[model samples]
Structures are given as C-alpha cells and as structure tokens.
Target: MSATRRQILSGAGASVAGIAFTGALSELFAGSASAASGVRAPGDRPPRGGYGPLVPDPRGLLDLPAGFRYKVLSRQGDPLRSGEGPVPSNHDGMGAFPGHRGRVHLVRNHENKTTGKLGVPTVPGLTYDPAAKGGCTVLELDGRNHVLGERVAVAGTAVNCAGGPTPWNTWLTCEETEDKAGTNGYAKDHGFVFEVDGADPRRTGAVPLTALGRFQHEAVAVDPRSGIVYETEDAFDRPFGLFYRFLPRKPLGGTGSLRAGGALEAMRVPGVPDLSAVRETGTRFEGVEWVPVPDPLAAETPIRFQDFGPKGITHAQKLEGCYWGGRAVYFVSSFARTGDGSAATHFGQVWKYEPHRRRLTLVVVFGPSTDIRLPGESPDNICLAPTGGLMVSEDGGGAQHVFGVSERGEVYPVARGRQNIGTPEEPEWGEFAGVTFSPDRSTMYVNCYTPGTTFAVTGPWHR
Candidate 1:
C-alpha cells in the first residue's frame, strides 16, 4: 500500500485557508444541527491550543494530552476469540456501531495484499476467494472499552483499504486494488466493496457489490436522507482518480440492498478537469453534474480513463478519507506534488459537497510546510467527533498524529504515534488510521498501520 515517496519541498508555513459564507453554508462551516446528528462540519482557521500539549506516554506506544490514556485492544498475530487463527496485519479503515447489551461493535479493515503475517481465516461460508488475503474483523467492546470478543467478519478479499459505515449498522469494506483473477494466484477479480455485518457475522455473506464500480476505492460516505453513496478513488497514476456517487437501486434498504445494483457515476465540475488545479480555499463549483461511468467494472480500462464525452470527469490526486457530516459529504485529497503530474501542488485539502445545491466547496486547504510533526499533510481516515468536530488521522512523513479540527478550525494533536515495532537501529512510526469514536463517544479507537495494533483511548473529551 506504500506509494513512491516524493521529496518534501520547503515552502511558506502551513495555513488553513477559508472564506466566510452566510446562511446554510455558514451553518455548514459551523456545527450544523441537521448534519448527521453528532458529526461536526469541516472548514475553519487553525487557532493554537486544543485539549493541551500532548504528554509523552510512559509505555512509549502513544502520546496524548494530559488527561488522556490508551489501552491496547488488539495486536497483530494475537489469538482471536473465535479461535480462527491469529489477527491479520495492516489495520486500516474502521467503523463503530451500537451492539447488544450496551456494547460497541467495531468493523475494521485489514489492508493486506497477497501476503501478510496471517490472512483473515477463510471460514467456509464467509470466504469470497480462497486465494485472497484481505478482509475485516469485528471487535465487541463494553462501555468501559473492555474487549468482549473478536472474530472474523469477512475474508478472502484483497487490499481491503478504507470503507464507510451504512445507516443500517453495517460496514462497507472497500478493496483498494485492480488486480484481476489471473494475476498473482487470485481466483477472482478484486476491487469491489463488500458489506460486513458487525452485529451478526452470519448476515455478512462476503459477496462483492460490483455495481458500486471496481477501482482503487479509498472510502465512501452515504447520505442518510438520500441513501446516495459517495465514493473516492485513490489511484496514484497519471490520470489520477475520479470522485464517484453510487445511486443504489435499493436506497436505504438494509444489508443486501447494494447487491440489487445501481448506476455508478463520476462527478464533473464543468470547466474544472482536475481538483488539484484549484488552489484557493473557498473555491466554489456550482452546477456540478454526474457523468455515468462507461464501465463500472473497468474490464478493459479504468473508470477514470474511460471517455466521458468532451466535458470529461474531474480528477484529483490521493482522494482518501470520506464521511457524511450534517447535510454535506466531506472528502479529502491527501496531497498533490508536481512530480505526480498534478495540475497544482498542496500539502492537503478537505472538500465539502452539498447534494441539494449541487455545489462543491473547498473548505480547508493546507499550505506547504517543512515540519514533519505538523498535522497538515496526507490526512487519511477521518470521523466526526461526538463533541462536535472532526478527527483526522495523519499518514504523512515523519511522526504521525491523530488531529482534531474543531468547528471553529482549531487544529490540535489528539494523539501521536510513538510505537516502533522495528529494530532499535532503524526505528519506524506507522501512520495512524481508523480514527473513530465509539457510539457513546466515551472512547476513541485508532489503528497503527504497521505491526498492526488497535487502541482504545479515553480522556476528558469535553475538555
């Protein structure tokens, strides 16, 4: 899952660029009462202090604010409660759902390719392709953040990257590869989203939702009101990737609804061909339209490469994290550099799309910075804070951190990665992923990508 590392260029200090707006847009910038209930909207300036300075951890695994502490919930190679072999590696995107007896269910993705320390157990009925090695695991935890049980939810999928949770309490685990059945001993074509039922493993069939389009999927956001599924493609190639929306035939229908099929379309901004070309913050693109994907399965060519008439679909570099907040669907462009064939370069960008108005707004743009500790570059997996804000997991160079951006736009570190599973002579800090809060928001759960580990963090969230 590692891409070619690009040179870090020095530039003006980091800045969270934004412009003022009134009415609904203003409410969107602030915490919208109608926005996905507890989720906070993105877009604001960065003020200094947040919870407070992060205190170094005594265990040397994580660094958090003064009042915060974390517990290791699960680690790679650990025995599973189901006795289905050991845990898999490369823990990535995850979703938290309400479980029975006041328990919280977490469905986590294992971004494993053809190889890993231990593949997700291909338990007979739950396996999609025996040759594949990437899937999801469901972890049950009580209110106190104590693990109740953990088991395999889905198995046999490959390159399971980041996916979003549905309104019906299931998780959409996306495959982040375009490998075909004949390649690398794969028995089936990969790169499709699979629905995993965290509450009941039996309900998850491990079937791929092919209508959602086959590509290098990064993440998805579903509109609670419309049931429209918005998807992001993370292809790092020359043509880059296109933002997509899957209009399910069975919108809002629970579980197997996505299997009924839907139209997969790419988003277009008329004159804007590449989103990376947009430099200024608050750059609004009105009258946005959706173009039907010529081939959702991409049997012969990728969706982004397929011709979309003279207008063509809009593309962006490193389209990563995505989630529904209030009335808008927020997505991230991790970063763009000149060496990557992007029209322009920037450290990071967060975009807000309003379906009702057919408007796309650039809410937050991170200016270039040389500091590796800064939380402005390569922002990945994100979730709405229960206390009204957004928590972004950093996947950039140097030390990684889980950052909190309040509705007022105050950027602060929520936690930092200090774990070095590698040798002491060649230390490595794995990028943080799956930054999500429990249903009650009492505990925050995140994952370390390398030497995979899950953490349950508790602290004075209100403070």
Candidate 2:
C-alpha cells in the first residue's frame, strides 16, 4: 500500500481523481456514516511541541524516541558455537528476553521468497532444504550487541514467517506454508506453531500446535491472563481472509507446552453477513465484532456482533500484523481496494480491539489523504513502543522504512533500507521487520529481514 497510488489519495470513500477541490477535502475528512455514525475520523494529528530525528541517518542506525543508541549485535554467517555453523540468512521474525541478562532469543524466518539457499547444508547436523530449511535460531545477546551463546537448527520447518513471543518466555515459530508435510521436507503439517525454549535444547518437547487449525499462518499473539492466543492468516483466495484466535485447552500458567488443544475462532465484522455484498469501495471500514471459530474451521463462522455492516458495508480488507498493545489488541490491514477502480489500493489502516468493552474501533488510516508521505506501505509485524505508540515494519520496496507512529496520528520514519539488502555485488542492510523493546522499554531490538541482521538499539524513544 504505497501513498503514491492515486486511488488511496482520494481519501475516505470518494475517488480523488478529477473531483472538485472542496469535494476531495470532504472525502478525506468525511467519517464513515454507516459505521459508528458520529465517531471522529482517526486521521487527525496533533501539533507536536517537540519532535525530530534522533539519529543522523536512521537507515543503518536505530531511531529511538529520544536518548537512545544502538550496537551491531550479530550478522549472518557469524559463528554461533564450536561445531554448529554460521548464522543462517533471511532473519525474519525475532524475540528478545530481558530476564536472561540481556540475552535475546530470536526465531529467524527464512523468506525463500527468492532463490532458496537457506544455510542448512552449511551445518553438519542440519540436513533439510526443499525450498530452504533454516527455521528458528536462539541467540543470547547482551545490552552491547554481544553474542553470549547461540543454538541453531529448529529442526523440520521452512518458509518460517513472523512468530510471536509467549507469556512463558518461549518463541512460537510459525511455518507460513499452506502445503502439509510429504509435499516437501518442510513441516510435516503446514500452518502450525512450534514452541522453542532457549534454556533447554536437550529438553526436546517441541510440538506443532495442531489444535490451532492449519492455514497460511502469519503471526500469533497470546494473552497472559487466559493464555488465549490471537492469530492472523495470509491467504489470498476468494473473499479475502480472516483474523483468528486460539484459546488453549488449559490456562497459561508458568508457560510449558503450547500443544494443548483449545477453541479456535475467526473475526467477523458482525452485521456484514455476506462479505461479497460489501462493495469494493476503499472507504475505511470500522466497528466490527468477533464471530465464532466455526465447526469445520474453514470460514463459515457464526456472527456474534452486528452493527457496522449491511447498508453501508465494507470489507475489513487484508488484516495483517497484529499484536497485544496497551490493554487492547491492535490490528492493521495491508491495504483496501481503492474505490477509484485502480489496481492499487494504498489506504492501509489500523484498528484497536477492546475485549473488555467488546468494541472495535478504527484508530488510523494512511494514504494520499493522510500524513504518511507514502500511502499503501504494507506494514508488516507491529509492536507497541514503551512510550506508548506502534512500531511498524514497512515491507514495501521503494519507501522501505521502519515507522514509529505516535498515538496522536503522527507517522515518522525511524529507519530506512538501503536500495538492495544483500547480494555479493551490492550488499546493503535494509528495513527493520520486527521491533521489540525490553520490559523496561529502555532498549529496542530491530532486525533487517532483507540482509538478515539483528541490532540492539538503545535510546530515548519515548518523548
């Protein structure tokens, strides 16, 4: 979802092409009449008393809110152990542990989006690579970006996308392939989450969370209170896809095994019974509710809440990048179809899910009408900054950047990607895919999936 697209430039519901100047303004400022009738638009930004870039060139260096610095913790091909092997490439998703004395455990998801060459053959014990088999890596890092200890070879997983950190200090590595085992040496069953622990490698209890129905798994977020895990899908078939939640069979106490079966459910905008009915208008949709998990676990979930659909119905669009931020769950769609009938839809949006209040609200939408210089920038993995905002990863190529979006609707780039990430001829690190802060929120750990490198960024990010 890039801002340069003319479709998203039109604003809320109307197309910006060849319209009256005043009409264009209204379209951008106009609130959705069908959903939350009188609610204010989420695109408003407050005047900043003080704000500026903290680093000289935020590209390689980490951009903190304020008073922060970063260090190169580790790079790909770095030696982990005596006989293990060099660090693999395409380090996608990562996690950091605070209690481990600054030791960070990361599950690097290899893209294989390009040519395979994953880095398994390099390791002696590791022997798997259909489209590339380099799953998760547990690396221990200090505050100064020093590698304390590391263990590689997650064993039997490929195309590992983004994963979520569990309440029990373990990383849940998810295989993003829709194909099951047998097709390739990847996960015997695709679309599953594997539990990996840093302290105990010999413990050997890693199991695939089959209960959490197999699909194009993107990311998972677990609720510490009930151990209920929220999930996202990356499917592109038919009426788009859905956002799901997995409730573990037992309570999440002390965090042991995540294999226990539980209830799995998908999200529904309630009143919008037929998703097909929603016209392909790129208006920012809001006021959605959760639906049941469905018996077959393949769409068809019963509606639970209905208020924002039907008459003025609109699709939730591509719901990707979700995380537990503040007291609520925050989710964002990659891009919505432009009402202007263009192949590109640059209006990317973010929403907040409040379980206690049982209400869903649109927090922000970016496009030609908004503050983001580039609309339609697909925001990948997201996390809430300690200063209380969202740290988003931009996977889009041209405007590739890591954004620190303030709660007041201010969007600023914290880092940028060098044109070409990695290649023998032109190797350049680019973009932070996953960003997480220490419990204290004083330090931030960022990773460049393009170059497959991770850095420890320490600074005063909180204004």
Candidate 3:
C-alpha cells in the first residue's frame, strides 16, 4: 500500500532525532530463537514439486528452489573476526565484490530508523556506535559461507533500504527517509545514496550523491557501460514517485571508487501530469517509454513515463525492490493503494524498464490467482536466479514464503514456512526480505528482519 503521511506519522514516534547516531550503537547481538518466522513444522515441507526431491526444509536456514539447498554462511551475532561483535539488526541490500580471489562483500541496510544496536569493536581503529541502527553493515564472506571480516557503523543513518551494486563493485546504500534535516539530523544526507567499499567493511564513508537529490529513496541500479546510476524512490504522495539516474562526472578508469560524484536526475512520465489516476490498470502490451532526465542534477525536474489510469499507476505506491538483469532493469511496488490509501485489488506488482529503449513493461500483477493463493499480500525484495527465473520474498504477513517464476510465466514454490520471524505486533517480519543467490547459483540467502535471522540455502538448479 502507498505509505501515507498517516503511516509516516504513526512511525514518527519511533523516528530518532539528533543525538549522534553513532552514540546510539551498543552491545552486539545474535539472531533470535525459532530459526525463521512463518516457517512450517518440519515434515510438512513441500516436496521438490518442480526443482527436485523433498529435501529437509532448512527451517531457520535459507530456503531455496526445491532441488536446491543452502547452508548458513553467517548469522546475526556471528563474529567476523576474532573479537568483532555480531552484525546489526535489519539487514537489507548487498552486492558481490570482485577480484581474482573474489568474495561477497555484503553492505546490509538496517530498516531500524530509531533503535540503536551497533556492534563491538575488535581493533584499535574501529568505530563503535551504540546508536547505529538504520545504517549499513559491511560483512565479508566467501562462497563457502566463511566469514572473512566485518565493519559495522558504515554510514551513520537510518532506514537505509534496498541499494544496488555499482560498476565499480561498490554497494550504493539508499536511505528511505524523506529530506527532513530540520528534524532527522541525517535527513540532509539521509535520502541520498551512500557508497561503501565492498572489499573492506571497516572502511565506512558517507558521501551524498547531491546530484541524486533527496527523497524517500528506495533502490539504485547501475548501467555498467555509461556509468549512469538509476534510482527509485518510495514517494506515493506528491506528484507520485520518481525514477532517477545519476550521470557521473567521470568514468572509472578501471572501476574506481564511488567518491567520484555525478549529476542526479528524477524521471517523469512523458505527457502525464499526475500519475495517480493510472494506478493499477493492466498493460496493453504497448511499447513503454520514460521522459528524459531534464535537470540531470535537480530532484524536482519531472522525468515521466507512460502508465495506466484505469488500474491506477502500476508503478505507483511505495516502490521498493530493484535489480538489473537480462539487459534491462526491473522494479517492484510494495503495494498499490488509492489516493485515499486504500488497498487496490492486488497487493503488489513487478515492472520492467528497458534502458536501451527507454520503455516499461508491467510484467506481473500479483494477487489471488490459481497458483499464488495469497491475495492482498505484498511482495518484497527480489533477485534474478541463474536458472532464468526471478526469486521473490513475500513480506505480506508474518508467515513468509519464497517463490520462483521463470521467464515463461511459470511460477512455483521454491521454499516455504519462513514466517514467525516477527511477532504480530512488531511489523517487518513474515519471511520475506533480502532474497539473493550466490554467484555460482548454487546457494541462496534469506533474511527476515523483525527478529533478525540469516539463512544459507543450497540446492541443485541448472543455471
């Protein structure tokens, strides 16, 4: 559903104001008991209906495609180094760091915009914060799930949500907060993208892509060739949400650091004034297109794209997860609500934006269908599977389930029983968040934030 001012206001009570976010950081913690929330009792595991035999459900561990299985690469409180503390709560976005001896450097975003649960310091130069919630956590891990090292307190901000991997192997962590520096001290730099080195988590730097402007940031996508970074926001109120692109000032001579700033531009629908009217209308298979990034650095300039009014803006609502795959960029809306903030017939949707042709395709409208029984449930984070399918984490209810759908539109269950992570009251669990696959496509990782837990899933899937 489109998060209204009422929603934001309701959460305002939890919003932490100035007080040096770092100071909020405190003792390190470990994953809560009960494995993962929303998970089913052991024996009821769905058989390998599509992928393979009915292997034992990982339970608290990562769930994967039927034929596939996984192992726990890391847990919430696991020590990355000898004396380092556990990772923080609310792990979000991450990316793979490249090198001959490549490893996955995960820059996890904490959705905790208020509470402070930062970890302990292992070395002399470590920065310890008792109030480091809502920032990003850096963890280095090998494919075998071996912990190489970790760095907490990366960017001292809150609600840092879904970010993307840049061409340079850096993870761009986006803050979902609106620009309210007047109150949220970090809001000035909070709504912009912060770059963190994937190789070294200890090395934390906060540089707002001023060119990227400020808004309720969601996710970021990069075009390796042009060095242009595309971004999505969760704004559902004013003028609707926008799709943006950051035109860097300089190209990396050899995949340099994100320290090289660039121009940020918001996208608007061409010829459409208010996209609010066309929220959920089904697609006509018409060729989709987006308006140009006018100011290139201004957040206000309109960058429009074609949408449906009969159904309301399909891309409307609190836009969340995003990924760059198959020569195109894909994004999903958290929920489709009316201007009055009422739930649409469907809970969520997935859309595709072809950068080369500058077009959009409303690929899927999720609801109560023959296959997916969950209607009015919102689909959260998504990742592309090597087997040419899309992996989605369902955040609708506390009992979360993961699913896979091939390019041909065939959908099936990959993993089940991921619920129970969050208590009914806390809001944020339900087994759907941070769904990703290993580079080799042999492993899968899932994280449920409310009562934080990380699962490593492995199985057989021909990528």
Residue-by-residue lDDT tens digits, candidate 1, 182-235: 888899999899999998977878889999999999999899888999999999
What would the TM-score be for candidate 2 when compared with the true structure?
A: 0.73
Scored by lDDT, the top model is 1
Backbone clashes for every candidate come to 2, 19, 47
Error of 2 at 440 (Å): 2.8
Q: What are the TM-scores, per candidate, against the unseen true structure?
A: 0.90, 0.73, 0.73
**Which of 1 and 3 is the better model by TM-score?**
1
lDDT score, residue 265, model 2? 66
lDDT of 2 at 237: 48
**Poorest 10 consecutive residues by lDDT, candidate 3:** 23-32
Ordered from best to worst lDDT, the candidate numbers read: 1, 2, 3
Task: Compose the digit string of candidate 3's lDDT tens values, residues 1-463.
Answer: 2243113212212221111111101100000011112232443222233453233444644334344555555556666454545666666665555434656665566666644554323233322222334666665677676767766635456577788777666777787765444454332424566676656544534545556656678888777667777778787464457666667788553334444666555444454433333444344234444334444333443233323333233235667887665456667676655644533434566666666776665555565332223312476777666454456666653334566654434445566543345455774434556776555445566666655555667655552
Where does candidate 2 have its weakest 10-residue lDDT segment?
15-24
